[model samples]
Target: MNSIPWSISPSTRGWRYAIAVSTVVLVGLFLAQGADLVSEDNEMLLYLGTLVFAALYLGRGPTRAATVTSLFILNVGHIHPGFRIGFHKFQYVISFGIFLVLSEQIARLADNVRREAWQSEELYLFTQECARLTSPQKVLELLCQHARRYCGLELFASLAQIKGAPLQTPRGIYGWVTPAVQGNLLLDSLQAQTALALERIVQSERSRQASVLEATQKLQSTLINSISHDLQTPISSIRGSVDTLKTCELPDQDRQVLLDLASDQIARLQKLVQNILNLSKIEAGGLILCLRWISVEEMVAGVVEGFPAPARARIRWQVAEEIPEVQADFSLLSQLLSNLLDNALKFSQGPVAVEVSAGLNSVRLSVSDQGFGVAPTEREKIFERFYRGQTPRHVPGTGLGLNICLGIAELHHATLRVEALEPGSRFVLEMPRKQEVTHV
Candidate 1:
């Protein structure tokens, strides 16, 4: 609800009072001269009605002024003698006294009613505004604004003790109202509301904090468990393969098989450790990009060559004839594509397709596999750190690859998204054809 405009200037109020009094006086004179419908007593009653109107709508000063003006106009113009202040009858004096007393009593009642109505409206507005706000600081700011606008008071909230009369709640002194006047019921109500709002905001913030702390603790627990399992599996495999080779006399082929098994486990361990390091660097804002213009064919060739010969046999690559070179960090971009290919190979069977296509202003690299496609609901979640989806086969992963890819894509000012194909999932990375590198 909007507030009443009671903050009129003294000059404006004086003009309004003059206009009201003049209109009443002119009507009274017109009745006395033009129409002999009302006697002198009735005319006085008419003036009394004007006084009451002033008391109700124009406030105390106007009411008192109108009372005095009504008495003078009645005595001079409408009394027994024409246009003269001669009190020929004692009854006139008593009538005048009665009118004055009535005006004062009515004015006092009207003023009290007006004040109470204004205070009620202010309280309603304050409560409504406070209800919509969630921050204690915002509520405090609202309190200060309300006090200044409605009460002509300057209010301030402080953490330390205020020297002057302070508006205090049960919790503590949140602020003070300045330029002390006599204690007012409206101001006291505002103080109480402010305190209650602050308490509510503080309690809400505490609950939110508690919920976040609980979530963080849960995430930390999950990370610890996943890391432990990932670390132990590789270490156990390498240890077992080494012990078997050391203990038993084996055929040349068997020895080579064990050696290859140990090597695979070691490679897996290295990848995990490297992923952990990359994640930390990304999170810490320490991963600096060494940007350069690199051809799409070269980048794809480099990433494909990193895989073992057998894994490479299952990979296929295609690059557009008129493809443009993109500005990116070669090492980071290679890592991103390698992670995507590795993820595709682990989840799918048959062949993995690595395709590079050029758009009007960007280049897109998509790694698609003939494996079980990602769930529609899990596509976005798969990019969150430590998030693993339900898969048909037990794919060995720490769930950090896609997240790392996302980080690298962001660093290159690119976008990475997964599309669910009919019997496969395609992960697409799009990078701008040209980039402005402010710092290398």
Candidate 2:
């Protein structure tokens, strides 16, 4: 709607043509006074009608010109004594001239109002777009387009580390352009204000993101330091006791019990240290998968065979006999499978079930538990570290197992999904048939 072309001239070509035609009409009316078109007693009324036409079409200056010319032609051309140039006639012209100036001033004032309203509307839309934007160059492009809506403009953007300094563009990236090539300098001033505002906003937002990343990194470091320090004492004690037990003489039953307790404690301590260490590795982005071309059949068999004796009755496997070779780190794969199976055995009420499918050069493994199925709303939440489910507190488990398994699977380029079945819940691991090099 604002595309009304508010340019150097508010008067249109149509208005110019109308004014010319109106002037000719006024002149003709005077020349036609001999045809009884011009009146004697109604002279005031005739001039008043012409004055209204002047206000309607030609505005102030033209209105006053029309008045004076009409008066002169009425006396000279009409030869009417009443239309003569007298003191009263001059007074009427002066009054009519004032009215024309007042009308002109009103038109100019209204035009200013419309222009300001249009600028406000454009500014509002530009602000909304700016609110959702972050990247400096993208914002600059938008700024140029915003100006283009009002009129065409050029744009350039730059990023600086500090206030008012030139930016260091890596890989030949430039940040700034001049508006001179495509648009008015007025638009440049508008863009400069926009850039300055965006600069402030971008600075504030960048500072916020930087602060969050810094805090997270700091927390991770603190946890790693604390965990490392905490493990030293128990680890040393466990190693010392293990060595002493090798040489000490004791009864067979007592030695057996001591050995069992020692082994269990050692396993518990090892699990805690390892969980934190794996988390630390992931946080630092130092995780590497030592992929080796290995058979999925062997991987499945190894995981089943490695299960604890206490859960032997709960174990079930339907691994594919002709599983294809998959590239994976054996140790990490073993750990992931171990964690998934361990979780199933711990939470499941009836016997746990394992199903392995091989197809189209890919493999998928699913572990199902007959215990309570996870609620739909909590499914995603269960994958986060240290998240305990709705299970009773007495259950002997740490929440880190599933989270670690997910992290390890991701590192190996595999996908993990949890689905709720009618009688149980299932954990599925999927790996692509072919691998490709990663790109940044």
Candidate 3:
């Protein structure tokens, strides 16, 4: 809007000319009233004053009218042989021409100054508005709208004309120019501001995407590292045991031992596979709860009984008689308890303790292992997928156990946390009390 021409239009010329004529007549009357104080030789000063005032305030067209009116007033009203300029003196003629040239130059200079100042103000406002906007499409649309509305210029924009390595954004690439005022500084500055804003938006999106990609890569690497040893070791053991039984005529006792070892390894493989599948199901958002109200004591006892005989011997339980039954998915709760027990056996040296208690609003189940406790810094890390703690390097695990436990707990709307005990670590699961389940 700032580029609007300062030139007087035909419609405005009539009023401006009238103002010029009125000012001239008024100045002449004032000079005549003070005629006794003013000399004929200094009469041109009054005429020159009117011209300068009009040029400064009313623009070039009005200034020209004032100059013409001055000449008529100077020759007819004040000069001798008033009605004709032919009788004017040589010095007076030279003075009149000089005044005409100087006044027109002043008007032209003033008009140029006005135009430059308006353009500067417009550029300032354009940049301020562009700075506030972050979206490219809105900037392009505003640019076009402002150009037409303010400057009366049509802005032509295209991606091809934009100079630089362009950004591919949801808003797409946009470049704009005021075709009629192609090399205008105001247009150039506006376009530059827009390009800078677009660059910032693109860089922000790229940075966000890079962070997500880095996290995904780290997760994939962790999963592969965890499963590689757990899967390979069990498969190799089972394969070697079977190969021995096939090749040699073994005694019955020896064959039985080999078969038992193979069966144990198979079981280990099956457990690892199940953990992997459960973790996948949780991550893929496919977990569904078949919630049931089951006796807390029975669930705890069953999980302990299902463990290997040696592990079962080391597990001690303290179940509160008043502990309330919990609402949970039966199978998922079983896996969750089994994982907690397995983790305690794998990490602890002394007997592990399973404690169940009830609060006013919730039931709490905790497994405490008497071993080297988790490091303070690694407390939260232990629950993350495939994250092995620093202390138990020799323990056989894929680091997926606790993560599976966490998922199962969440599905039942429960909380699982690890507390570093004085001499070991304690894992606690709390299930909130809810209304009786609607059977499905």
Could you say which candidate leads in lDDT? 1
For 281-380, candidate 3 gives per-residue lDDT tens digits of: 8878877777778888998888887776677899999998887777777778888998988888888879999999999999999999988789889888
- In terms of TM-score, which candidate is strongest? 1
Would you list the C-alpha lDDT of every candidate in the order shown?
0.81, 0.65, 0.78
Itemize residue pairs with steric clashes in candidate 3: 1-150, 1-151
TM-score of each: 0.85, 0.65, 0.61
Q: What is the descending TM-score order? A: 1, 2, 3
- The predicted structure with the larger TM-score, 2 or 3, is 2
Error of 2 at 195 (Å): 9.3
For candidate 1, write residues 260-309 as lDDT tens digits: 87887787777778788888898788888888999989999988987777
At residue 413, what lDDT does model 2 achieve? 71
| Alpha-carbon deviation at 227 in model 3, angstroms | 1.3
Superposed by TM-score, candidate 1 places the C-alpha of residue 371 at a distance from the truth, in angstroms, of 2.5
- Poorest 10 consecutive residues by lDDT, candidate 2: 165-174
Residue ranges of candidate 1 with Cα displaced over 4 Å: 1-11, 80-98, 101-141, 164-182, 251-253, 437-440
